[model samples]
Target: MAVSDECKIKFRELKAKRSYRFIVFKIDQQQIVVETLGGPNQSYDDFTSSLPSNECRYAVYDFEFITAENCQKSKIFFIAWSPEISKVRMKMVYASSKDSFKRELDGIQFELQATDPSEMSLDIVKGRAI
Candidate 1:
């Protein structure tokens, strides 16, 4: 599947202007498109809750976290969420198409794939930030 031009533009807006807190993308009509965007005020819980329990999606989250040294830092995380309950065929398609999709985003700082939410839990994200 190809990444749509709107997807690229939205990513650029998120990266350059912090226009969004998170972006959820999905395969639509053979193109990867933005399904929804979290506003800057949205929390991590909000983003996580936005994900459907039985689906596959690609997301980018702006994670602003406090470091062990008591400093503030932010990282852009590219996450591929494919739950075990989702269709195997859909998982395969998402897995195979990930590289091509993320490559177009330009500034993702961390890459994570989750077959289960625990794998991409807050602790894991914090660990990556550390």
Candidate 2:
């Protein structure tokens, strides 16, 4: 999916603020793509602390896991969304595990796509969605 310039700008601003342990791009109303940066033992507080202060209609926390081959894999383990701050406060819909703070990406309204960590581009982090 193509990201707009506006979204890229928002991403860059958030990166500059060090606001997100992971970054997910809302491709559309029903789809979001994400890349995880945190370790396997990441905490919920640490996760929330990384969120951008700016409004994000929807977001998914990508949890990284090590596979049998020692490859890192990501899975959507948490979801958050806010229609409008004035109307409703942003909330976390799910958490993966009590100890792991992980949740499976299933039955979500928005399709969460997990991309390769290497796919995360500096341009996107700099607010230029390439």
Candidate 3:
């Protein structure tokens, strides 16, 4: 599937920030890769300061891509943090097909995992209930 303009814009914003992580899911392989993108998250000041270089300070993010031809888009959800803030903020973004934004939106919703104190989380994409 092609990456929508909206998705490109988000990537540009992330690129400009110069720090973020991406969790890209490859459908063929049925796996995801959580890696650093153009830059590191700019929030880890403590660790950043202690690092050998400035690149050490940045936000860590994970992205999941839905690449089934049957599915034209994917829902992206992750935690965003910054030194200016006290708590981690969870955000949701969507990558929709140019002609099927509505369909994609209908298939997506968020599931918050606040009940688990050990690992509070948010999932924007819930393809299956299981």
Top TM-score model = 1
Poorest 10 consecutive residues by lDDT, candidate 2: 94-103
Candidate 2 regions exceeding 4 Å error are 1-25, 28-31, 57-77, 83-104, 107-130
Strongest candidate by lDDT: 1
Sort by TM-score, best first. Answer: 1, 2, 3
Q: What are the models' TM-scores?
A: 0.95, 0.29, 0.22
lDDT tens per residue, model 3, 1-130: 3334443444445434423433221111221222234334432233223322211111223233455555443332332222222222211122222123223222223322221222322222233212
Give the per-residue lDDT digits (tens) of candidate 1, residues 1-130.
7899989999899899999999999998789999999999999899899888999999999999887799988899999999999999999999999999988999999998998888889889888977
Candidate 1 structure, TM-score to reference: 0.95
Whole-model lDDT per candidate = 0.92, 0.36, 0.28
- Which tens-of-lDDT digit does each residue in 1-130 have in candidate 2? 2334544443444334434444443334333334334433565445554444444433444444466688774443334433233222222322112112212222122232112222222222222211
Winner on TM-score between 2 and 3 is 2
Candidate with better lDDT, 1 vs 3: 1
